[model samples]
Target chain A: MTERIVVSPGDLLGDGVFETLHLRPSGPWLLEEHLARLVRSSSILEMPEPPVDRIRSAISDLSVSSGALRVIYTRSGVLNVSVSTIPATVLRERREGVRVLTADLGFTVRKPPPWSLSAAKSLSYASNFAARRWAARQGADDVVWLSTEGYVLEAPTASVVWLDGGVLCTVPPEEAGILPGITAEHLLSLAGPAGLGAAQRMITGAELSRAGAIWLTSSLRGLAEVVELDGVARDRSPWTPRLLDLLGF
Target chain B: MTERIVVSPGDLLGDGVFETLHLRPSGPWLLEEHLARLVRSSSILEMPEPPVDRIRSAISDLSVSSGALRVIYTRSGVLNVSVSTIPATVLRERREGVRVLTADLGFTVRKPPPWSLSAAKSLSYASNFAARRWAARQGADDVVWLSTEGYVLEAPTASVVWLDGGVLCTVPPEEAGILPGITAEHLLSLAGPAGLGAAQRMITGAELSRAGAIWLTSSLRGLAEVVELDGVARDRSPWTPRLLDLLGF
Candidate 1:
């Protein structure tokens, strides 16, 4: 059942932080990392510390074995918890990979505003959704945002992860001033165990196209391989299955 | 009584557009302009056309004589109409003017992305609120965002307006890619009747500080003069009360 939440109109102004986690039969995957990121996001918004104990208790009471679990905390200290079925698109993209369009985001990675919350998982996500919608209109499944200098930054709702030889690389969150994707970080940590090296580096859009493999990493989608970039079809990579299996997708 | 709204988790994601209008004893101020902007905002987000007649009907059903009336429309076709008391700070600022800090918004006026919603009143307002919070922390009441090239843009929640020589001037919404301020435009339309010239011009932050007078124009606040900018005090402009009276505030 779709859950409904009661909120003040002020809450609708997008002054809040949120976390979406993949709920497994055992429990929420990477609950600790997600919670830690939630705290960091709140700090970036200058919000008061969230009530961690209350949040844990709320999660513990959930009866759903698997789905998407969302926790939202508004600037006015209002908290909401809800569970929803995963969208069919998420599953399809994970299985068949995604066609991504590369577009200039018109942002400079080096010069975010002093009060920039670009690194925060703030509720103000209209731009992100708009970018994906634009991709869909262009006959692509998703979009990868590039900085003004042509550096591949990240995806609309995910982090850009690429494989170069035996090295697994993703953009450095702090340097790029983007939300540190929990799923991407976790996947990179497993690279060494999978006989690969992990690295964080910035690459131009043209250079990114030459990588061994490209994937957009997020919580629910796990890793959606970039099967086609900017209308250019790419050969399937062997690492796709291995990386997905290592992440237990 | 404070009103509560029931919304889905998707509604809190900030993928929506909204309008806030001043409710007076007679009726909502600039109702048509506000509704027009709402439609423009929805278009920018690529949402289906909003049910305008329904919104008008809902506003007519409002019982309160004076307050802040808000209409929110999410990308998922959810529409919410609510009324609430304006914050005391808005009144205080309107009465005594505002102390504003100038900061670079890290945006280039000329390079907005294809899917940019900067001109729309989207629900992605966390950055706007964050900028205001940063100003308050710095002992100011508001902030004026400057483009990366140092040209004056707009305030977090208002449009920048000023008196240059004998002309009333504002930033061109189309050229600057900022939200079209209904209040500012209406005020400028009255400039001729008030025996003043009106214009849309671009100026640098330094030039803005040297204007004869500066103000932030919005619905509820009407006009909040910038009495102090970047910790530099300026004498109160005699035009403040005259403009306020002209606007019926």
Candidate 2:
């Protein structure tokens, strides 16, 4: 059943922050990290700290074995928690990989605005959705946004991770001025046990294209390998399943 | 009484478009223009055409003589019309003038992304709100964004207009890729009758400071003269009230 919430018209203005989590039979994966990011996002928006305990209670009340769980907190102090079945497209992207396109975002990371919410997982996601739609129109499954300087920033909804030699690398969130990816960071944390070096580096889109393998990482999709970029197809990387298993997907 | 709308969680993602109008005793001011822009904005977001007849009926049903009227349409096809008391701050700004700050938006208008919604008044207004908060922190009433190239763009919630000798000017919406301001456009259309020539020109932040007068124009605010720019005070221009009246504020 679709869940609905009563909200003031002001609450619909995208003046809020949100977190999406992968709900598993075990529990919501990376709950602490997602919650912490939610607080950080709210601070960036100058909103009051979210009620974490209430969010936890709302999550606890859900009886679904596994699904997608979302927690939203608006500037007007409206908090909503809802659970829905994961979309089949997300699962398909995880298993079959995604064809990706690269586009200049026409913005620089060097000097972001003082009130920049780039680091926040704010609810103003229209542009993100539009960019993905643009990708679909271009016959690709996703897009990686590059700063005007040609540096790879991230995908609209995911973090860009690439294998460079024996190292696994992703953009440093602080340096890129983007939302920190919980899933990508967690995967990097476990890289050592998987016999790969993990690092955060600013790589240009051209440089990214030449990497051994590339993937877009997020909560629901886990990680979708980039099988094609800018119309060029790439061979499947041997580490896809290994890393997926390493992250317990 | 506070108005409430029942919405699904997805409706809050700022994946929507909206227009604000000055409600008047005569009727909702500039109703047709606003509804037309709403359609254009929805097209930009790739949403289906808004139910114009429904919105018209909603506006006609409002009995409030005067207030701020907002029409919102989400990607999920939710249409909402709400009327609320105009904030005292808005009235104060219109009458007392506003101190403005100019800040680099860290983006170029030269080539906005293909999926750019910069020209649309999308519901994703977190950054716009944040910019104003940043201005307040700087002891200013509002802010005007500058493209990375230093060209003045628009205020967070309004358009920048200025007087250059006997001519009135504003940034061309198409060239600057910012949301076109209905209030500013209407005022410009009547400029000839007000004994002023009007033109849309790209002006830099530095150059704008030398203009005879400047104001931020929006639907509800009408026109708020810039009392100060970047902490430098300017003498009140006699055109402030004249332009406000010309726009039928």
Candidate 3:
């Protein structure tokens, strides 16, 4: 499907917005939430918000019950939607969990530049992809980024979340100055009813490793439980499947 | 021409490389120099060097002169060369001059990140363009960026050069960890024979503003003389046109 979208040669500069959804037999899961984020993302880049109707029209077809869904919006004024095979790495992580490492990203902690689209899911995702590739090369399944100040940030392609005793937690977007993770937000919203509490707070990487059960959450992967952090291995927590079912995965 | 390319939609993500040459009646001015920069840029993004012959074939009916020539290369595997009308403001600056402001960009003096592409002219150019847009929004013609330690860095899209008495000087790319400015390098090379000394040294913005004449140099604009530093107006120097002509603008 990535090859199917016809576009201009200039569209590949990574100056675009994109959303990845987990396609379920029911439909593109969390479709509205993802679409809303796309619109918000576009606005941050000073791009015109894409009409939601057009997005709906593009993905209205009935087909694959399960796959990875992607919507890309470019500064050159192109919006495209597509579906493809779900990555095997995502499936493996969902099942067996993952080993993770942490590193400082060293970005400006002050106000982002006037044109900063840090909150946008822009297609300029080469660095994100490269970070993941670097993690793979280092024998870790994923990486959790830190600010130069040593405050924990998000994962390259997912949000960092943890079960701090009974309180489920994720970082605050405004304070962290990161793209708000839709899947993590949805999960946090559901925490209260799941007999747990949820909070948004900044934590250091060391604090994260000591949490009850750490996971990287995203639309496609849903949740990849961390079985080993840094180097110490741990047994899988029993809550992984329960949370997936709650999310209707 | 933007509409003519047979590109897949994924091409728009800002994850690419580009070369902007000063197009002249004699074909692209400094074509070899620009191609070498393109190759250096490709290595920064971990992409394969594109086939130069393919790029050469695209420049067939080379009929245009005195324009801005840009060649875009995307990780999605598309090589696009385009020639367009240069911005009138650029020409105006060549004829007149520019009011310049300096600000600290907060980049550390330490080595760039392992994955940093700061030295490359990769297509993740939204920030570079945004900085210029920011300057325009602030009512200045352009901005000269400074490092976190207050060392004078390059401009958003050009190299910063100043005349200290009879010596012509600019920041050394290797020492400053910046994208080497092709125009500035060429100008500095000819400075000695022209009876002006040439040097590369790290200087503060205050030191630059105190210099006799200040200018921003790039391939397209050649040299944009600084008519004002900060809020203080300065007279246009006689060397602006001489240097532009020397570079064959």
Candidate 4:
């Protein structure tokens, strides 16, 4: 589906929040979760409460059956919903996994500024994109950010999840003060059904290296296994396909 | 004059740079400096060099005089120039001074990540504006950010400038990894003509408190004297107006 939008200068200031969902034949995947995150993001930006009913109506009006759905809401009260085909790279990463690098993000987990937007997926995502580009320069498909103290944080655009001692775990959002990963949390909830344990805990880079399997989870990519990390190749995990199936990817 | 335009989804990602200039009867004040800074900002964001000739032509086409001139350029090669009346609060701040609060920005000066955009004046200004709103909630007009080590950094939207022993100084942009302040540099250049010395140095918050005068300098506000800092009232210095006149504000 093709779409166009008229925007004011203020809307371009990045003082906004947005949600990207994996549109399916049935509907956008986990849409309510994405919308809830959007509201949380807006609140962090100190923006007015988004009109959720209006957003739902807008999504229902879209003619495209499956692709990517984007909802953008600016502080200027502009709301835009559009549909487009998901990038081939996203699908490729899901099928083939991704090469990942680890780098110190230069931020301390314990001392965010009072107005820190770390917990919000604000539209100020230049650094997020920049980190990916820097990874590309290093010949990696993506990056997993580490806090200055060597603790594993989230990826640039995804949440870091791993299997350790038969237990599935992801970083705790509140303690890390990061954007809560909806997809990772959902996947963790499914671990019990898959005959595994689920938990949320902090891990250092060294501890992460010892995990049985590592993956980055997001809405569009679903779960991209870190097939290669820090130049070391990893054997394909048997759980990768099963987890993808469980998530309906 | 009012204007509207169409933007792509990528345009709202805050992956661009902008310059806010003071439009004057004789054209934009310090236009060259502002343009140079724009180039530097774009470079930091890995965007291609902005078309300087196009920017100059666009500025020449504006009919409005003596207001705020905003130039926005996205990574998608979209360039926009618009004019709007300066906010009355800006002029008032220049005249009446501002109550300031000092807060730890929770950023260490030495460890910015490889892809950090801290030095760029990118469109991702949501955090900057959020900090100001936070200051407002704290019963202050503005805030001066301090580094994690308690060194004085710039304000949310301006540079920190202070006077000591008849010498006027501001933090060095490169050393502080901040957006260089065009107005403050110009003011410093004119300090010799105003019978004062100029320098760039790093100082702690305590040292800044003991300075004869302190100010936050930006394009629109010119020089907002810090009349009260962290509940401690400061005496007005004679240099405020003389430097303002020298800068032709």
**Residue B163 error for model 3, in Å?**
2.3
lDDT of 2 by residue, B1-249 (tens): 899999999999999999999999989889899999999999999999889999999998887879999999999988899999999989999999999999999999998999999999899999999999999999999999999999999999999999999999999999999999998888899999989999999999999999999999998999999999999999999999888887777
Give the C-alpha miss distance for residue B184 in model 1, angstroms.
0.3
lDDT by candidate, in order shown: 0.91, 0.94, 0.80, 0.90
lDDT by residue for model 4 over A1-249, one digit each (tens)? 346578887677899999889999989999999999999999999999889999999999987888888899988888898888889999999999999999988778888888889899888888998999999999999999888788898998899999998999999998887899999999999999899999999999889988999999999999999999999999899999999999998
Model 1: residues >4 Å from true position, as ranges? Answer: none
In the predicted model 4, the residue pairs found to clash are none
- The candidate maximizing TM-score is 2
**Residues B7-51 of candidate 1: C-alpha lDDT, one tens digit per residue:** 887888898899999998989999999999999998888888789
List, residue by residue over A117-147, the lDDT tens digit for candidate 3: 6677877766776677777878999888877
**How well is each residue in A93-129 modelled by candidate 2, as lDDT tens digits?**
9999999999999999889998999999999999999
User: What does the lDDT read for residue A170 in candidate 1?
Assistant: 98
The docking category that best describes candidate 2 is high
- The TM-score measured for candidate 4 stands at 0.98
Q: Rank the candidates by DockQ, best first.
A: 2, 1, 4, 3
Chain A TM-score for each of the predictions:
0.98, 0.99, 0.95, 0.98
Candidate 2 Cα errors over 4 Å, as ranges: none
lDDT, residue A87, model 3: 85
Q: How well is candidate 3 docked (DockQ)?
A: 0.49
